[model samples]
Target chain A: MTAVAAPTRRRRQRRHISPVVWLFLLVPAAIEVGLVFWPALNSFYLSLTRWNGLGAPEQVGLDNFRELFSDGVFREALGNNVIWAVGFGGLSVAGGLALAVALNKPRRGVGVYRSAIYLPMVFSLAVTGLFWRVQYQPDGTVNTLLGAVGLESLERQWLADPKTALYAVLVAAVWRQVGYVMVLYLAGLKGTDPSLDDASAVDGASAWQRFWYVTWPQLRGVNTVVFAVTVIDSLRTFDIVWAMTQGGPYHSSELLSTYMFQQGFTFLNLGYASAVAVVIFALALLFIITYLVRTLKEEVS
Target chain B: MSAPAVTAPAPPAASPSTSHDRQRVRRRGWAFHAVMVPLTLLWVAPMAFVVLISIRGFDDIAARGTAALPDSFTFEGFRTAFGEGAMGEALWTSVQVTVPAVILSLLLASMAAFALSRYAIPGRRAILLVMLAGNLLPPQILLIPVSRITESLGIYDTLVGLVAIHVGFGLGFYTFVLHGFMRSIPSEVTEAARMDGAGAFAVYARIVMPLCRPSLAALGALATTWIFNDLIWAITVLRTQAKFPVTAALLNLQGGYVSNWNVVAAASIMAAIPTAIVFFAFQRHFVSGLLMGSAK
Candidate 1:
C-alpha cells in the first residue's frame, strides 16, 4: 500500500512530456479559433454595418434592426420556419419512434426493410430536392396517382402553392430523415431490458398498454436527443428548399437558411444576412442547451 | 419504409400453428403486406421516376413531357451529363476537394481524438461540447465570415480553401465521437501495456489505434458523405466556377436549365452515387456511430 502510494505521489511529479500532445491539441483548437470563433466575432461586427460584400461597412448601429422589423418578407419567412420546425421536427420523431417500436421484434427480413428505408437517407440532399421536384410537377406521378383515384380536382401544383409547398418539401424531408431517427431509436431500444418486457407480457398487458407504460419511459433519454436534434435540423434545412424552389413563388417556403443565403450572396446585404444568421444561431443554441439542461437535471435527480 | 411496423411481436406462447393462432397470423400477414405495398411504392417512386426520366429519349420527353415514361430507353442524359464535359469537369473538381478534405479531416480529427483520450488534457470535455455545439449551428451563419477569413488568408475560391473549410467544420464532431469511443475502452488494457514497459507512443501505435478501427471506418464514411453532399457552404465560400465541386455544379444546373429534366435527373443520380457507395459499404458502423454519439 505504501509503495502504491509512493507511485501515486510520484504521479504528481512534473513529467516533462514531449511537445507532440500539445501539437495535437493546438492544431484543432487553432482551426476552431480561426475559422469558427474569429468569424463568429466578425459576423457580429459586420451585422452592425450596412455594407455589401466588397465595400467598407458603414456602422448603422441597429438601423438594420429597424429595417428588419418592417421587412414583410422576413416576417413571412419567420412564420414559415416555425411551421417548418413543427412539421419536420415533430412528425419525423413520432414517425421514427413508431417505426422503431414496430420493428423492435426479431422478425425475419426486418433488415431488408431497414436498408430499403435507410437507402433514401444515403441520397444527397440535392438529389432528394431534384427527386421531389420531379414528383411535384403538375403531371408528376403523385398527381397521376391521385388522378387515377379520381381526386384530380385536388391535384394542384404542389411546390407552386405557397401554402402547400413547404409541406410538400416536408414529405421528402421526412422520407430521408425518419430512417436516421429510426436507426437511432432502434439502437436505444436495444438497450432496454428484455426481462421487463417479458414481465409486462406475462402481466396480460396489451401491446398499446405495454408501449405507453414501459417502452416510452425507457426510451425517454433517446427521445430527448432525437427531439432536440430534429428541431435544430428542421430549422437549418437549406439544400432541399434551395434545390426545390429557392424559397418559391411567394416566399411561402422561405426558411431562414434560404433567406440568409439569398440576402448574403445574391443581394450582398451582408449585415442583414449576418443578423439573420445570428437569429438562427441563437435558436439552435437554445434548443441544444435546453435539451442538455433537461438531460443533466434528469441525471442529478 | 414502414416495414418496421409490420413486425409486431406476439408472445412466444401464442404459437401460430394453432388454428385460432393461424387465423390471427394470416390476418396480420395480409394486413402487413397490404400496408407495405403502397408504402414501399411511395418510398421508391422518386428514384424510379428520376431513373426512368433520365433514360427517356429527348423526343419522348418533348412529346409526352418530363413526367412521362419512356417508350424506349436511351443513355442520352448520361451521355449529355458526362459527354458535354460539364459533369466530368465537376467530377474532377469534386474528387480534388472531397478526397483530400475527407482524408485530412479524418486524420487530424483522429489524431486529436487520440491525444484527447490518452492525455490529461485541460478543458477536454468543454472543448468537445464546443465542437458539438458548432455542429448544431446552422452553417449559413458561418458562410460569409468563413469566406472573408479564407480570402484574407489568400485561399478563398480555391480547392484547398474548400478542403480547409470542410476540415474546420468536420473536426469537432469527428473528434467528439472518436473521443467518446476511446473513453469507453477499459483503462486496464493501457495500464497493462505500460507495466510491460510499453512506451506511450508504442501503446498508441500498437494498441489504442488498432482498437479504434471501427470508429475510424465510421468517421471516414460519414465525412465522405457530408463533404460530397455539401453545396451551400461550398457555393457561398467558393466563387470560382472551375473550383466548384459536383454539388455546386449540380446546383447551378438547376436555375439556368429548369426545362432540362433529363439532364437534371441524370446529374442528380450521379451526385447521389458516391454517398450511396460509401453508405452501403459501411452502413452498420454509420448507424452505430450516429447512435452512440447522439446518445451521449
Candidate 2:
C-alpha cells in the first residue's frame, strides 16, 4: 500500500493542476451536483419520512416501504414494470438486430430503407402516444383494419380495455425503441472484421454459423451498451405511458414511474413517492453498476 | 450510381468481373429486399397514417375512419392547429429553451472534457463516475428536489429555468462523450502548442475545440432533438400555458381535440418537424458520433 501510495503522491506533486482546470471543471460540476446528486440524496432522506410538500417532513422509519409492499396498486405497478422490461428489451433487441443485419451492406436504396425505419426515433413520445391513441380508437385505424381483414372479433378498444391497454402501449414504445437500437447495432456492425467472415466461410460455415461464431462474439461491447440502454429505458418509461393511458383502466397499465408521479404531484404523498423512486433507483442500479464497472475498467486502463 | 466497393476483397479471379460471385450476391440482395421492403412499409405505416390523417378534412375522417383512403384533403387542420391549438407559440417556446440549453450544455461540457482529459486533476475518475451515474438515474427520482430548487431559485415557470435544468442534466453524457474524443487527440499536438508558450486555456481554445467539430455537431443535433421533445421537465417546471413547450402544448391539444383527429394529427406533425429536419440534415455526423462513442 505504501509503495503504491508513494508513486501516486510523487506524481500528483510533480504535475500541479492549473486554476484553469479547476475553473473549467468546477462550474459544471457544481451545477450538476447541486441539481442532480443533491436532489437525489435529499430524496433518499425524504423516503424515510412523511411529507406533504407544505410542511416539514416528519420522520418515519421504513413505514412507507412497508406500506408500498402491501399496496395493491404498487404491486401491480411493480409486476407491470417487470413485464415491460422483458417485452420491451426482448422485442427491441431482436427486431433491431434483424434490421441492422439486413442493412449492414451497401445496397441500392439502403439508406432510404434505414431512414424510413429510423425516422420514428425522433418523434416525441407525446406525439407517438397521441398518434397511436387515434389508431387504437374503436373506429380508428386498428379496428378498421381488423374488420377489413375479416377479423372483426379481434377488434377491441385497444387502449381503453384493461386487458389490452398495457400491451397496446408496449407496441408503440417498441416501435420507437427499435430504430434507436438498430442504429446502435449498425454502428457495431461497421467495426466487425471482414477477414474473419471470409475465413469462416472458407471453412464451409453457413451464413448462420458465420454470423454466430464470427460476428456475434465481436459485438460484446455493443451488447453491453444495448442491454444497459434497453433496461434503463424500460425502467424509466413514463412519457408515452403518461400520454396514452395515464396508468388507467383501474391501474392495469400502471408503472412505477407513473405511480411515482401521481403520488408525488397529484396526491401530494411526497414520502411515498420518494420510496417508489428509491425502488426504481435500486432496480436500475443492477444494470447501471454492471455497465459502469466494465466501462470504468476499460477507461482507467 | 456506382455501388460502393465491398470492404472485403473478392477472391482472386481471372477478371475483375466474376459472374459466379455476382450471381450469389444478386441472390442475397434479392432475399434482403424481399424481407426489408414489407417490413419497412409496416414499420413506417403509423407515421404515414398520421400524415394522411393530418391532411384529410375532419368531416372526411368522421365519415370514413382514419384507416380509409382520404376522399379529399385540405390545409384546414394545420391552420387550426397553429391558431386555436396555440402550437405555434409552443414551438417558439421550445426553440428558445432548446437552443440556449444545447449551446450552454455543449460549451460547459466541452470545457469540462478538456480539463478532465488533458490535465491530471485530482479525483478525475471519481468525478467522471459521478457525472456518468447521474445521467443514468431516472429523472423522476430527482423530480421533487429539482422542482423545489427551481421554485426556490425564483426561475420556475420561466423558459430560463427550463434551460438551466436541461444544461445541468445534459452536462454528464455530453462531457463523457467529449472527454473520450479529446483523449484520442495525440499528446504531441498539445505538447507542441505548449512549447510555443500557449497556456492551458489557449491550447484548449485554439487547438482542441476545432478538432472536436464533428462530435460537437453530432451532439448538437442530438441535444436539440432531446431538449425539444422533452415533456416531463417542461411539465414539471412550467405551469403557465403560454410558457409550455411544444410537447406539453400538444398534449393539451390532444385533450381538447378528442374527436378532431385531423387537428391533433396536425399538431403532432408540427411538433415532430424540427427533430425530423435535424435527423435528416445531420444523419452522417450523428451516425459517426454513435460509432465514436461506442469505440471509446
Candidate 3:
C-alpha cells in the first residue's frame, strides 16, 4: 500500500510540474516583452535624445522636458486632455448610470431598446467621426433639424470652430461611450440581489432613496470599471479627432495622443515626440497603478 | 412555475384593488415605452442616415445639399465605391489582417491564460498586472519604437507587420479577459483529465478549450470587430494604398471624395458592415465578456 501510494503521489507531482506550462508561456511572454514592454521602455530612453527617423539620436538630456513645459501647443494639448478626462468621463458615466437605472426594470422590449442604443458602439470611431462630421456641416442634419425646430441661431460649424471642436468630438465620443457604461452597469444591476431592493421597498424607502442607499453601493464594482475605462479612453482619444478635424483649424482640438502622433510621425521629431509620449504614459500609468493596487489587494484578500 | 400565479389577478373581493394596481403598472409601462422608443430611435438615427445616404444619387446630393431628401435611390454610390473607389480592395486587405490577427491573438492569449490561471506559476500576479498595464497604455507611446523595430525586422510597410503588432497589442487585453474566464472554470475537470493520464496539452486542447467555447466566441467576436475597425496601427505601419485596411483606406477616400458626400457616405457604410454583423451575431457573448472582465 505504501509503495502504490508513493508512486501515485510522485506521478501527481510530475503532472503538476509539467514543462508544458513554461512552453505555453514562452511565446506570448516574448511577444509581450518584445512588442509592448520593450518599446514602452525604449520611449523613456528616446525621450532624452533628439532624433529624426534618418539620423543618429543626439542626447539632449532634459531639454525636451524643459521645452514641453514652455511649448504653447503642448500646454494646450495637455489642457484639452484634462477637459476631455473630466467632461467626457463625467458625462458618459453619469448618463450610463442613469440609463442603466431606467432600463434595469423588467419591461417588455427593453432588449430592443438596449440594442438600438448600443448600435453606434459597434461602428468604428472612424464611422462615428464621419457620421458626425456630416451632421455638423454648416447646412447639415443638425443645423437643419435646429432650423426645423426654429432654433437656427443655435447652429454653427461644430467641428471647424476652435471653441466647439473639442466639445463636438466629445459629443460623438459620449454617444459611443454611454452605451458601454450602460451595458456594464446593466450587468452589475443584474448581479444585485433583488431581495435587497424589495427589502428597502418594504421598509418604506422611496425609489431615489433605495437607489442612493442600496443600488448605488451594489454598483460600486461597475463604477470603478467605468471610471477606469473612461479615463484610459479619454487619454487615448485619437481616431475620431484625427478623422474628424485632424486636430485642425489651428490645433484647437489637439489631444496628447494626436499631438504625439503628429510630432513623431508627421514632423519626425522623435525625441520631442518621445517626451510627449512619456508624459502620456506617465498619466496613464498613474491610474493603472492605482487600479492594479486595488485589484491586486482584492485578489489577495 | 409560480410566475403566472403571482402575476394573475386576485380573488373577487380584492378585484378593485388589483385592477387599480394593474392600471397604474400599465400606465408606468406605457410611460417607459414613450421615453425609450424615441430615445432608441434617436440613438440609431445616425447609422440610419448613413444607410439612407449611401444609396442616394451623387447628382441628387450635389444638386441639393446632404440634407435634401433623395428624389430617387440607386446603388450608384456603391458601384463607384467598390469600383473606382477601391473600397473592395481595402476591405479585402482588412480581412487579410484581421482574420489572422484575431486567430493568433486568441490562440496565444488562451495558452498564456491557461498556464497563468491553472498552474502555480511564480510571479503570476506580476504577470497579470504587466499584461493589464500593457493593454491600458496608449498606443502612441509605442509608435516610434515599434515602427523602428518593424523596419529593422524588415516587416514594416507589410501586412504581416500590422498583423504582428495587432496580435501583440491585442494579446494583453485578450489574456486579461481569458484569465478571468479560465479561473472561473472548475479545477476538477482538468484534474480529472490529468488522472486519466492526459498530458498538459491534452488537458488544455481537449478539456479546457472545449469547455471555454462561449468565452472563445465572445472574445473572437469582440477582437474581430476591434481589429477590423483599427485605424491607428494600419496608418502607422502600412504605407502603400494597396495595403491599406478599410479604415485607413476610408481616410484616403475622404481626402479624394471630400466634396462628394454620396461616395464617402457609401464607403463609410460599407466599412461599417462587418463589425455591425459581428456585434449583432455575438451580442450575448460580447456583453457577457465585457461584464466578465470588468465585474470581477
Candidate 4:
C-alpha cells in the first residue's frame, strides 16, 4: 500500500512539515542542538586557540595539533589508546560471543548463570575500578592465588607497575564490558531461526560450519550495533581507567580521554585539550558515521 | 493402531532423529555446565572478595592482608561509609539526577521519535543520523565547552544542570531506539486513529506512547544506570563535594580511603546497589526492547 501511495504522499508532504510536527521536534532539537551539537562544534574552534581559562583564548591555528604530534606524552597516550582499542574490543567481543553462544539455550540454571555473568556489567566503572584495585593489590586475591599456585614470580604490583598497569586496567574494563556484549549477542541470537540450524545439521554440517554459515549470517544487525558500540567504547573509555590508575605509573595507561581530562582540567591547557578532544571526536565520528550512513540507507529504502 | 485410516507413520524417521538430536543436546549441555561453572565462579570471585572485605574489620584486613580469610565480621564499614564517607547523601543526590533525567529524556525522545517516524518532515534523515553520531561522540570532546556553557549559565555546581546535560546527551540514542520501535507499529492502526480525527499530539500520547512502553521501559532502565553511574559530567559541572553523585562520591571515597579496603569496599557496594537493582528488575524488558529495535 505504501508503495502504491508513495508518489502522491511524497509530492504532498515533501516540503511541508505540519505545525504539530514542529511542536514535537522543537524541544528535543533545541536541547540536542543547543547543549550538545553547538558546544561540540565550538570545541573545534577552541582547538585552534590557546586559553588558560583565566585569560581570553588567543588564536594559534594548527599549533596545538602540531605540538600534539610531537609531544611524547601525547604519543604515549595515543599509542595506549590504540592498544586499548585492540585489547578491549578483541577480548570483549570474543568472550561475549563465546558466552552468548554457550548460554543461548535455556536450561535448568541458565538464568542463574546469565545473571552471574552479567552481574559485573551493572556495577559502575568507578566501583569496578575500586573493586579491582583491591583484587590487584600485592597481597590481594590475584597475587595470593599466584603465590598459592607457585607462580609467585609472575605476581607483582599490578596497578603500581607501569609495565602491567595498562593491561591490568584493560582486564577490569573488559570484565565489566564482556557481559554487556554478551547480552546484546544473546538478543541477536534469539532472532535467529532454529530451523536453519536444524537444516544445517540434517545436511551433516559440522558445528563450526553451521555456526559460520547459518547462524552468523542472521546476526548482521546485531553485529553492526555491537561493532559501533565496541569501537566507540574503546575510544571513549575513561571512568575505569581514571578510577583505577588515573592513567598513572608514568602515563602508561593514559587514554586520549584521560589525557584530555588531564590537559583540560588538571593542567588548564584548554586549547591543547580541545585539540585532543577533536582527535577523539574525529576518530569516533569516522566509525559511527559509517554506521549511521548504513542505518540511514536502510531506513530510507 | 487407532489411526487405521491414516497412512503409515512416516517410517519413524522424525522420532529417531529427534531423540538423536536430544541426546546430542544433552551432551552439549553437560559440556557447557562443566565449562561455565568454573568461568562463572571466576567472574563472581572479585565481587565476592569485595563483599567479604566489606564485612571484615579494617584492622583485620590490615593485619592479615586482603587475601586472608576474614577473622572479624562487622557492619562498621557500612556505617562509616554511609556517614563519614557521605555516600548516603550522594545516593540521594544520584536519585535526584537519575530519575528526572530518565523521565525527561524518554519523554522528549518518544515525542521526537513519534514525529520523525510518522511524518515525512524534510531533513528528517539528516537530523536522525546526526543525533545518532552525536550520541557516540566521546564526552571528553564536549568537556571543555559544556563546562564553559554550564558556568556561563550560572547553573554550574547544580543538579539541574547535570540533569539537563544527561537528558541532552541521552536524547540521541533514546530517540533512535524509540524511532525504530515506532516505525514498526503498523501504519494502519495510526491511520485509523487519524481517520477518527485524532490530532498528531493526541495520536502520539494516546497511541504511540502506549505501544512504545517496552522500549521506553528499557531505555528508562538503561538511562537510569548510565546517568547514575556517570562520573565525568558530575566531576565536570559540579564542584561541591556535597552535590556529587554516588559514583563521583565513590571515587572520592577511594581516594580518601587509600588502601583501607574495608571502607572502600562498602562504599563501592553502596554505589552499585541501585543500578544492580534496576538491572535485575528490568532485565527482561531491556533485552526484549533491544531485540525489537534491532528486529527491523
- Best model number under DockQ: 2
**In model 1, what is the error at residue B210, expressed in angstroms?**
1.8
Of 1 and 2, which scores higher on lDDT?
Answer: 2
DockQ of each two-chain model: 0.49, 0.61, 0.57, 0.46
Per-residue CA lDDT of model 1 for A123-184, tens digit only, reads 87878988889888887878887888999898999999987898898888988998888888
Candidate 1 residues lying further than 4 Å off, grouped into runs, are A1-17, A291-301, B1-19, B192-200
Better model by DockQ, 1 or 2?
A: 2
CAPRI band for model 4: acceptable
lDDT of 4 by residue, B23-70 (tens): 676787678779989999999999999999999998999999998888
Residue range A26-75, candidate 4, lDDT tens digits: 88988998789989998999999999998789999999999999999999
In angstroms, give how far residue B29 of model 4 lies from its true place.
3.3
Q: Where does model 2 exceed 4 Å of error?
A: A1-16, B1-25, B292-295
| Chain B alone vs. reference chain B, TM-score for every model | 0.90, 0.92, 0.93, 0.89
What DockQ was computed for model 4?
0.46
Worst 10 residues of 3 chain B by lDDT: B1-10
Off by over 4 Å in 3: A1-16, B1-14
RMSD of each: 3.3, 3.2, 3.2, 4.5
When candidate 2 is compared with the true two-chain complex, its DockQ is 0.61
Residue pairs with clashing backbones, model 2: none
What is model 1's DockQ versus the real complex?
A: 0.49
Question: Residue A301 in candidate 4 has what lDDT?
Answer: 78
**How much is B90 displaced in model 1, in angstroms?**
1.5
